[model samples]
Target: MILKINDLSVRLGGSHILQGVAFDVAETGVTALLGRNGVGKTTTLRAVLGEVPATGEVLFDGRPALGRATHRLVRDGLGYVPEDRCVFAGLTVAENLRLAVRVPSPDFDLVFDLFPELRQRAGQRAGTLSGGQQQMVAIARVLLNPNRLLLVDEPTKGLAPAVVTAVAAVLERVATRVPILLVEQNLAVVRRLATDAVVLEAGRTAWRGRAADLLSDADATRSLLGVGTTAGRH
Candidate 1:
Protein backbone atom coordinates (compact mmCIF):
# COMPACT_ATOMS: atom_id res chain seq x y z
CA MET A 1 0.00 0.00 0.00
CA ILE A 2 1.11 3.53 -0.65
CA LEU A 3 -1.12 5.17 2.00
CA LYS A 4 -3.13 3.84 4.90
CA ILE A 5 -5.57 5.42 7.38
CA ASN A 6 -6.40 3.26 10.36
CA ASP A 7 -9.22 4.30 12.71
CA LEU A 8 -8.52 7.94 12.00
CA SER A 9 -10.66 10.59 13.65
CA VAL A 10 -10.48 14.35 13.35
CA ARG A 11 -11.72 16.91 15.85
CA LEU A 12 -12.30 20.49 14.82
CA GLY A 13 -13.89 23.05 17.17
CA GLY A 14 -14.69 20.35 19.73
CA SER A 15 -16.68 18.20 17.30
CA HIS A 16 -15.53 15.04 15.57
CA ILE A 17 -15.49 15.68 11.88
CA LEU A 18 -14.20 12.27 10.84
CA GLN A 19 -14.94 9.21 12.95
CA GLY A 20 -12.94 6.08 12.57
CA VAL A 21 -12.28 6.63 8.88
CA ALA A 22 -10.06 3.91 7.47
CA PHE A 23 -8.98 3.17 3.91
CA ASP A 24 -5.93 2.33 1.83
CA VAL A 25 -4.64 3.40 -1.55
CA ALA A 26 -2.24 1.30 -3.57
CA GLU A 27 0.60 2.41 -5.76
CA THR A 28 -1.43 2.00 -8.95
CA GLY A 29 -5.15 2.74 -8.64
CA VAL A 30 -7.77 5.35 -7.78
CA THR A 31 -9.87 5.36 -4.60
CA ALA A 32 -12.97 7.57 -4.58
CA LEU A 33 -13.80 9.14 -1.21
CA LEU A 34 -17.50 9.66 -1.86
CA GLY A 35 -19.75 11.60 0.46
CA ARG A 36 -22.49 14.23 0.55
CA ASN A 37 -21.95 17.86 1.41
CA GLY A 38 -20.60 18.60 4.94
CA VAL A 39 -19.98 14.92 5.50
CA GLY A 40 -16.28 15.59 6.27
CA LYS A 41 -14.68 14.68 2.95
CA THR A 42 -12.36 17.69 2.99
CA THR A 43 -11.56 17.09 6.66
CA THR A 44 -10.48 13.55 5.83
CA LEU A 45 -8.04 14.80 3.21
CA ARG A 46 -6.69 17.39 5.67
CA ALA A 47 -6.08 14.69 8.24
CA VAL A 48 -4.12 12.63 5.73
CA LEU A 49 -2.04 15.71 4.90
CA GLY A 50 -1.79 16.58 8.62
CA GLU A 51 -3.47 19.97 8.31
CA VAL A 52 -5.37 19.46 11.56
CA PRO A 53 -5.08 17.53 14.79
CA ALA A 54 -6.12 13.92 14.26
CA THR A 55 -6.16 10.70 16.26
CA GLY A 56 -5.40 7.12 15.29
CA GLU A 57 -2.86 5.91 12.78
CA VAL A 58 -1.84 7.53 9.51
CA LEU A 59 0.83 5.32 8.00
CA PHE A 60 2.68 5.70 4.76
CA ASP A 61 3.90 2.22 3.75
CA GLY A 62 3.76 0.90 7.36
CA ARG A 63 5.59 3.88 8.85
CA PRO A 64 4.06 6.51 11.13
CA ALA A 65 2.92 9.66 9.25
CA LEU A 66 0.92 11.52 11.88
CA GLY A 67 2.13 14.98 12.99
CA ARG A 68 4.02 15.41 9.74
CA ALA A 69 3.51 18.88 8.30
CA THR A 70 1.89 19.40 4.91
CA HIS A 71 5.15 20.45 3.27
CA ARG A 72 6.86 17.40 4.68
CA LEU A 73 4.19 15.23 3.09
CA VAL A 74 4.90 16.94 -0.22
CA ARG A 75 8.61 16.21 0.16
CA ASP A 76 7.72 12.61 0.99
CA GLY A 77 6.06 12.15 -2.41
CA LEU A 78 2.48 13.23 -1.61
CA GLY A 79 0.70 15.92 -3.64
CA TYR A 80 -2.49 17.77 -2.80
CA VAL A 81 -5.02 19.40 -5.12
CA PRO A 82 -7.22 21.37 -2.77
CA GLU A 83 -10.98 21.75 -3.28
CA ASP A 84 -10.61 25.44 -3.85
CA ARG A 85 -7.83 25.98 -6.39
CA CYS A 86 -6.03 28.89 -4.71
CA VAL A 87 -4.21 30.08 -7.82
CA PHE A 88 -2.45 33.40 -7.43
CA ALA A 89 -4.39 36.05 -9.32
CA GLY A 90 -1.46 38.37 -10.06
CA LEU A 91 0.83 35.59 -11.27
CA THR A 92 0.97 34.18 -14.79
CA VAL A 93 0.03 30.55 -15.36
CA ALA A 94 3.70 29.63 -15.63
CA GLU A 95 4.47 31.48 -12.43
CA ASN A 96 1.70 29.72 -10.49
CA LEU A 97 3.00 26.35 -11.63
CA ARG A 98 6.56 27.32 -10.79
CA LEU A 99 5.53 28.24 -7.25
CA ALA A 100 4.03 24.80 -6.64
CA VAL A 101 6.95 22.77 -7.99
CA ARG A 102 8.71 21.08 -5.07
CA VAL A 103 11.89 20.01 -6.89
CA PRO A 104 13.42 19.64 -10.34
CA SER A 105 11.18 17.23 -12.19
CA PRO A 106 10.25 16.14 -15.72
CA ASP A 107 6.73 15.66 -14.35
CA PHE A 108 5.94 19.22 -15.39
CA ASP A 109 6.00 18.07 -19.00
CA LEU A 110 3.49 15.35 -18.16
CA VAL A 111 1.14 17.98 -16.70
CA PHE A 112 1.24 20.00 -19.89
CA ASP A 113 0.58 16.83 -21.88
CA LEU A 114 -2.53 16.14 -19.80
CA PHE A 115 -3.82 19.72 -20.03
CA PRO A 116 -2.63 21.25 -23.27
CA GLU A 117 -4.50 24.46 -22.55
CA LEU A 118 -1.97 25.23 -19.82
CA ARG A 119 0.82 24.85 -22.35
CA GLN A 120 -0.97 27.10 -24.78
CA ARG A 121 -1.49 29.92 -22.30
CA ALA A 122 1.57 29.59 -20.11
CA GLY A 123 2.16 33.35 -20.23
CA GLN A 124 -1.36 34.41 -19.28
CA ARG A 125 -2.28 35.42 -15.72
CA ALA A 126 -4.06 32.64 -13.79
CA GLY A 127 -6.78 34.95 -12.42
CA THR A 128 -8.11 35.58 -15.93
CA LEU A 129 -8.63 31.92 -16.83
CA SER A 130 -11.99 30.21 -16.85
CA GLY A 131 -13.02 27.94 -13.98
CA GLY A 132 -12.13 24.76 -15.81
CA GLN A 133 -8.77 26.12 -16.97
CA GLN A 134 -7.99 27.26 -13.43
CA GLN A 135 -8.83 23.80 -12.16
CA MET A 136 -6.39 22.36 -14.70
CA VAL A 137 -3.71 24.76 -13.49
CA ALA A 138 -4.32 23.69 -9.90
CA ILE A 139 -3.94 20.03 -10.81
CA ALA A 140 -0.95 20.70 -13.06
CA ARG A 141 0.78 22.54 -10.23
CA VAL A 142 0.74 19.36 -8.14
CA LEU A 143 1.59 17.14 -11.08
CA LEU A 144 4.84 19.07 -11.50
CA ASN A 145 6.07 17.62 -8.20
CA PRO A 146 6.30 13.95 -9.26
CA ASN A 147 4.41 12.75 -6.18
CA ARG A 148 3.42 9.09 -5.80
CA LEU A 149 0.12 9.80 -4.01
CA LEU A 150 -2.37 12.59 -4.88
CA LEU A 151 -5.08 13.79 -2.52
CA VAL A 152 -7.65 15.43 -4.79
CA ASP A 153 -10.72 17.13 -3.35
CA GLU A 154 -13.69 18.14 -5.54
CA PRO A 155 -11.96 18.83 -8.85
CA THR A 156 -15.24 19.17 -10.76
CA LYS A 157 -17.10 21.41 -8.35
CA GLY A 158 -19.01 24.28 -10.05
CA LEU A 159 -17.88 23.17 -13.53
CA ALA A 160 -20.04 22.74 -16.61
CA PRO A 161 -20.82 19.24 -17.80
CA ALA A 162 -18.40 19.44 -20.72
CA VAL A 163 -15.67 20.88 -18.50
CA VAL A 164 -16.26 18.12 -15.96
CA THR A 165 -15.85 15.57 -18.73
CA ALA A 166 -12.60 17.16 -19.81
CA VAL A 167 -11.23 17.28 -16.24
CA ALA A 168 -12.23 13.69 -15.69
CA ALA A 169 -10.17 12.73 -18.73
CA VAL A 170 -7.16 14.52 -17.28
CA LEU A 171 -7.63 12.69 -13.97
CA GLU A 172 -7.79 9.37 -15.81
CA ARG A 173 -4.45 10.18 -17.44
CA VAL A 174 -2.96 11.32 -14.11
CA ALA A 175 -4.03 8.08 -12.39
CA THR A 176 -1.79 6.10 -14.73
CA ARG A 177 1.22 7.30 -12.70
CA VAL A 178 -0.11 8.52 -9.33
CA PRO A 179 -2.47 6.83 -6.94
CA ILE A 180 -5.40 9.30 -6.56
CA LEU A 181 -7.62 9.53 -3.50
CA LEU A 182 -10.42 11.56 -5.07
CA VAL A 183 -13.04 13.25 -2.90
CA GLU A 184 -15.91 14.08 -5.20
CA GLN A 185 -19.69 14.48 -5.18
CA ASN A 186 -20.25 13.61 -8.82
CA LEU A 187 -21.04 9.94 -9.21
CA ALA A 188 -20.42 10.02 -12.95
CA VAL A 189 -16.86 11.19 -12.40
CA VAL A 190 -16.35 8.68 -9.56
CA ARG A 191 -17.69 5.83 -11.67
CA ARG A 192 -15.28 6.72 -14.44
CA LEU A 193 -12.10 7.05 -12.32
CA ALA A 194 -12.41 4.90 -9.21
CA THR A 195 -11.61 1.20 -8.77
CA ASP A 196 -12.92 1.19 -5.18
CA ALA A 197 -15.52 3.27 -3.34
CA VAL A 198 -15.30 4.41 0.28
CA VAL A 199 -18.55 6.11 1.16
CA LEU A 200 -18.92 8.44 4.13
CA GLU A 201 -22.10 9.19 6.06
CA ALA A 202 -21.73 11.86 8.73
CA GLY A 203 -17.94 11.34 8.76
CA ARG A 204 -17.99 7.59 9.20
CA THR A 205 -17.32 4.78 6.76
CA ALA A 206 -20.88 3.70 6.04
CA TRP A 207 -19.85 1.49 3.16
CA ARG A 208 -16.70 0.24 1.43
CA GLY A 209 -16.79 -1.86 -1.72
CA ARG A 210 -15.86 -1.98 -5.37
CA ALA A 211 -17.05 1.07 -7.28
CA ALA A 212 -18.83 -1.22 -9.70
CA ASP A 213 -20.75 -2.89 -6.90
CA LEU A 214 -21.90 0.36 -5.29
CA LEU A 215 -22.85 1.78 -8.66
CA SER A 216 -24.92 -1.31 -9.35
CA ASP A 217 -26.86 -1.37 -6.10
CA ALA A 218 -29.70 1.11 -6.04
CA ASP A 219 -30.38 0.57 -2.37
CA ALA A 220 -26.85 1.48 -1.38
CA THR A 221 -26.98 4.56 -3.54
CA ARG A 222 -30.25 5.66 -1.99
CA SER A 223 -29.22 4.98 1.59
CA LEU A 224 -25.68 6.30 1.52
CA LEU A 225 -25.45 8.64 -1.49
CA GLY A 226 -29.00 10.09 -1.48
CA VAL A 227 -29.31 9.59 -5.22
CA GLY A 228 -32.27 8.38 -7.17
CA THR A 229 -32.10 4.82 -8.43
CA THR A 230 -30.28 4.28 -11.71
CA ALA A 231 -29.47 1.24 -13.89
CA GLY A 232 -25.80 2.04 -14.41
CA ARG A 233 -23.12 -0.47 -13.50
CA HIS A 234 -19.38 -0.13 -13.88
Candidate 2:
Protein backbone atom coordinates (compact mmCIF):
# COMPACT_ATOMS: atom_id res chain seq x y z
CA MET A 1 0.00 0.00 0.00
CA ILE A 2 1.15 3.52 -0.72
CA LEU A 3 -1.10 5.07 1.91
CA LYS A 4 -2.97 3.84 5.00
CA ILE A 5 -5.17 5.54 7.57
CA ASN A 6 -6.35 3.86 10.77
CA ASP A 7 -8.77 5.21 13.33
CA LEU A 8 -8.43 8.72 11.93
CA SER A 9 -10.47 11.32 13.76
CA VAL A 10 -10.84 15.10 13.53
CA ARG A 11 -12.75 17.94 15.20
CA LEU A 12 -13.16 21.59 14.24
CA GLY A 13 -14.65 24.41 16.30
CA GLY A 14 -16.43 22.03 18.63
CA SER A 15 -17.78 19.90 15.80
CA HIS A 16 -16.62 16.41 14.98
CA ILE A 17 -15.66 16.22 11.33
CA LEU A 18 -14.04 12.83 11.10
CA GLN A 19 -14.82 9.85 13.30
CA GLY A 20 -12.40 6.97 13.09
CA VAL A 21 -12.11 7.00 9.31
CA ALA A 22 -9.78 4.41 7.86
CA PHE A 23 -8.88 3.35 4.32
CA ASP A 24 -5.97 2.03 2.27
CA VAL A 25 -4.69 3.12 -1.13
CA ALA A 26 -2.49 0.86 -3.13
CA GLU A 27 0.71 1.85 -4.94
CA THR A 28 -0.80 2.16 -8.42
CA GLY A 29 -4.58 2.58 -8.62
CA VAL A 30 -7.32 5.14 -8.11
CA THR A 31 -9.35 4.89 -4.91
CA ALA A 32 -12.43 7.10 -5.03
CA LEU A 33 -13.59 8.68 -1.79
CA LEU A 34 -17.33 9.29 -2.29
CA GLY A 35 -19.84 11.12 -0.14
CA ARG A 36 -22.36 13.93 -0.21
CA ASN A 37 -21.47 17.47 0.84
CA GLY A 38 -20.40 18.30 4.44
CA VAL A 39 -19.65 14.68 5.20
CA GLY A 40 -15.96 15.32 6.02
CA LYS A 41 -14.61 14.15 2.66
CA THR A 42 -12.53 17.30 2.38
CA THR A 43 -11.61 17.22 6.05
CA THR A 44 -10.39 13.66 5.72
CA LEU A 45 -8.04 14.73 2.95
CA ARG A 46 -6.89 17.72 4.99
CA ALA A 47 -6.23 15.57 8.03
CA VAL A 48 -4.22 13.11 5.99
CA LEU A 49 -1.99 15.97 4.83
CA GLY A 50 -1.81 17.50 8.32
CA GLU A 51 -3.74 20.59 7.25
CA VAL A 52 -6.20 19.93 10.06
CA PRO A 53 -5.48 18.86 13.61
CA ALA A 54 -6.39 15.22 14.12
CA THR A 55 -5.52 12.02 15.90
CA GLY A 56 -4.66 9.15 13.63
CA GLU A 57 -2.06 6.86 12.15
CA VAL A 58 -1.19 7.76 8.55
CA LEU A 59 1.29 5.41 6.96
CA PHE A 60 2.89 6.21 3.60
CA ASP A 61 4.78 3.29 2.15
CA GLY A 62 4.27 1.70 5.59
CA ARG A 63 5.92 4.56 7.54
CA PRO A 64 4.09 6.75 10.07
CA ALA A 65 3.18 10.23 8.71
CA LEU A 66 0.58 11.48 11.14
CA GLY A 67 2.20 14.73 12.31
CA ARG A 68 4.34 15.57 9.33
CA ALA A 69 4.09 19.07 7.90
CA THR A 70 2.39 19.70 4.57
CA HIS A 71 5.62 20.49 2.75
CA ARG A 72 7.22 17.41 4.17
CA LEU A 73 4.37 15.34 2.86
CA VAL A 74 4.84 16.81 -0.61
CA ARG A 75 8.58 16.33 -0.42
CA ASP A 76 8.00 12.74 0.55
CA GLY A 77 6.11 12.09 -2.74
CA LEU A 78 2.57 13.24 -1.93
CA GLY A 79 0.74 15.69 -4.18
CA TYR A 80 -2.56 17.48 -3.60
CA VAL A 81 -5.03 19.27 -5.91
CA PRO A 82 -7.68 21.14 -4.03
CA GLU A 83 -11.17 21.65 -5.51
CA ASP A 84 -10.66 25.35 -6.05
CA ARG A 85 -7.83 25.01 -8.60
CA CYS A 86 -5.51 27.33 -6.74
CA VAL A 87 -3.11 28.60 -9.33
CA PHE A 88 -1.02 31.74 -9.00
CA ALA A 89 -2.80 34.72 -10.53
CA GLY A 90 0.18 36.63 -11.88
CA LEU A 91 2.34 33.69 -12.82
CA THR A 92 2.55 32.28 -16.32
CA VAL A 93 1.52 28.69 -16.92
CA ALA A 94 5.12 27.56 -17.27
CA GLU A 95 6.12 29.47 -14.14
CA ASN A 96 3.37 27.82 -12.13
CA LEU A 97 4.48 24.37 -13.20
CA ARG A 98 8.10 25.22 -12.45
CA LEU A 99 7.21 26.35 -8.94
CA ALA A 100 5.39 23.10 -8.08
CA VAL A 101 8.39 20.86 -8.63
CA ARG A 102 9.76 19.74 -5.28
CA VAL A 103 12.55 17.62 -6.74
CA PRO A 104 14.37 17.43 -10.05
CA SER A 105 12.36 15.41 -12.52
CA PRO A 106 12.58 15.09 -16.29
CA ASP A 107 8.84 14.79 -16.82
CA PHE A 108 8.01 18.18 -18.33
CA ASP A 109 7.53 16.63 -21.74
CA LEU A 110 5.04 14.14 -20.38
CA VAL A 111 3.08 16.86 -18.64
CA PHE A 112 2.79 18.92 -21.83
CA ASP A 113 1.73 15.85 -23.77
CA LEU A 114 -1.06 15.17 -21.32
CA PHE A 115 -2.41 18.73 -21.66
CA PRO A 116 -1.30 20.16 -24.97
CA GLU A 117 -3.09 23.44 -24.35
CA LEU A 118 -0.70 24.19 -21.52
CA ARG A 119 2.21 23.86 -23.90
CA GLN A 120 0.55 26.19 -26.40
CA ARG A 121 -0.31 28.64 -23.65
CA ALA A 122 2.97 28.30 -21.78
CA GLY A 123 3.44 32.04 -21.57
CA GLN A 124 -0.14 32.90 -20.64
CA ARG A 125 -0.95 33.95 -17.09
CA ALA A 126 -2.56 31.14 -15.13
CA GLY A 127 -5.38 33.26 -13.73
CA THR A 128 -6.67 34.19 -17.18
CA LEU A 129 -7.19 30.66 -18.40
CA SER A 130 -10.66 29.08 -18.44
CA GLY A 131 -11.68 26.82 -15.57
CA GLY A 132 -10.81 23.67 -17.47
CA GLN A 133 -7.46 25.08 -18.54
CA GLN A 134 -6.66 26.14 -15.01
CA GLN A 135 -7.54 22.67 -13.83
CA MET A 136 -5.07 21.30 -16.30
CA VAL A 137 -2.45 23.59 -14.82
CA ALA A 138 -3.15 22.27 -11.34
CA ILE A 139 -2.98 18.61 -12.37
CA ALA A 140 0.07 19.24 -14.52
CA ARG A 141 1.76 20.94 -11.60
CA VAL A 142 1.67 17.68 -9.65
CA LEU A 143 2.79 15.71 -12.68
CA LEU A 144 5.94 17.80 -13.04
CA ASN A 145 7.16 16.41 -9.73
CA PRO A 146 7.70 12.89 -8.51
CA ASN A 147 4.70 11.53 -6.68
CA ARG A 148 3.59 8.24 -5.17
CA LEU A 149 0.14 9.40 -4.12
CA LEU A 150 -2.22 12.18 -5.26
CA LEU A 151 -5.16 13.58 -3.27
CA VAL A 152 -7.50 15.13 -5.80
CA ASP A 153 -10.65 16.82 -4.43
CA GLU A 154 -13.37 17.00 -7.04
CA PRO A 155 -11.72 17.51 -10.41
CA THR A 156 -14.95 17.67 -12.40
CA LYS A 157 -17.11 19.87 -10.22
CA GLY A 158 -18.76 22.64 -12.26
CA LEU A 159 -16.98 21.63 -15.43
CA ALA A 160 -18.73 21.15 -18.75
CA PRO A 161 -19.18 17.65 -20.03
CA ALA A 162 -16.44 18.09 -22.65
CA VAL A 163 -14.05 19.51 -20.08
CA VAL A 164 -14.89 16.75 -17.65
CA THR A 165 -14.02 14.19 -20.26
CA ALA A 166 -10.70 15.87 -20.91
CA VAL A 167 -9.75 16.04 -17.26
CA ALA A 168 -10.87 12.46 -16.72
CA ALA A 169 -8.54 11.32 -19.46
CA VAL A 170 -5.63 13.07 -17.83
CA LEU A 171 -6.48 11.51 -14.48
CA GLU A 172 -6.70 8.16 -16.18
CA ARG A 173 -3.15 8.55 -17.44
CA VAL A 174 -1.89 9.77 -14.08
CA ALA A 175 -3.33 6.69 -12.33
CA THR A 176 -1.21 4.51 -14.57
CA ARG A 177 1.91 5.76 -12.75
CA VAL A 178 0.83 6.81 -9.22
CA PRO A 179 -1.82 5.81 -6.76
CA ILE A 180 -4.68 8.32 -6.43
CA LEU A 181 -6.95 8.98 -3.45
CA LEU A 182 -9.66 10.85 -5.29
CA VAL A 183 -12.65 12.63 -3.72
CA GLU A 184 -14.99 13.02 -6.66
CA GLN A 185 -18.79 13.18 -6.87
CA ASN A 186 -19.21 12.53 -10.57
CA LEU A 187 -20.57 8.99 -10.55
CA ALA A 188 -19.78 8.48 -14.23
CA VAL A 189 -16.15 9.46 -13.82
CA VAL A 190 -15.92 7.36 -10.68
CA ARG A 191 -17.42 4.38 -12.46
CA ARG A 192 -15.10 4.79 -15.43
CA LEU A 193 -11.84 5.40 -13.55
CA ALA A 194 -11.97 4.15 -9.98
CA THR A 195 -10.82 0.62 -9.32
CA ASP A 196 -12.09 0.72 -5.73
CA ALA A 197 -14.08 3.05 -3.52
CA VAL A 198 -14.50 4.04 0.15
CA VAL A 199 -17.75 5.79 0.99
CA LEU A 200 -17.84 8.14 3.97
CA GLU A 201 -21.01 9.01 5.80
CA ALA A 202 -20.91 11.56 8.63
CA GLY A 203 -17.10 11.30 8.58
CA ARG A 204 -16.98 7.57 9.03
CA THR A 205 -16.36 5.00 6.32
CA ALA A 206 -19.70 3.41 5.39
CA TRP A 207 -18.73 1.16 2.50
CA ARG A 208 -15.70 -0.37 0.84
CA GLY A 209 -15.55 -2.47 -2.32
CA ARG A 210 -14.89 -2.48 -6.03
CA ALA A 211 -16.22 0.60 -7.87
CA ALA A 212 -18.34 -1.66 -10.04
CA ASP A 213 -20.00 -3.20 -7.03
CA LEU A 214 -21.19 0.16 -5.77
CA LEU A 215 -22.37 1.23 -9.22
CA SER A 216 -24.35 -1.92 -9.77
CA ASP A 217 -26.00 -1.91 -6.36
CA ALA A 218 -28.61 0.86 -6.74
CA ASP A 219 -29.98 0.33 -3.28
CA ALA A 220 -26.53 0.72 -1.80
CA THR A 221 -25.97 3.84 -3.89
CA ARG A 222 -29.30 5.43 -2.94
CA SER A 223 -28.80 4.62 0.71
CA LEU A 224 -25.23 5.91 0.85
CA LEU A 225 -25.44 8.82 -1.60
CA GLY A 226 -29.12 9.80 -1.21
CA VAL A 227 -29.61 9.53 -4.92
CA GLY A 228 -31.45 6.89 -6.92
CA THR A 229 -30.09 8.25 -10.18
CA THR A 230 -27.84 6.12 -12.31
CA ALA A 231 -24.33 6.94 -13.48
CA GLY A 232 -23.88 9.78 -16.04
CA ARG A 233 -27.17 11.40 -15.07
CA HIS A 234 -27.73 14.92 -13.79
Give the best candidate by TM-score: 2
Model 1 lDDT tens row, 172-224 = 98898889999988888888899988988898888887888898888898888
Clashes of each: 0, 0
lDDT of 2 by residue, 165-232 (tens): 99999999999989899999898899889999999999899998898888888898998988765654
Q: Which 10 residues in a row give candidate 2 its minimum summed lDDT?
A: 225-234
**Most accurate candidate by lDDT:** 2
Candidate 1: segments with Cα more than 4 A from true spot:
229-234
Global lDDT of each model?
Answer: 0.86, 0.90
TM-score of candidate 2 on Cα atoms, chains taken together: 0.97
Cα error of candidate 2 at position 136, Å: 0.3
RMSD each, Å: 1.6, 1.2
lDDT of 1 at 232: 31
Model 2: per-residue Cα lDDT at residue 168: 93
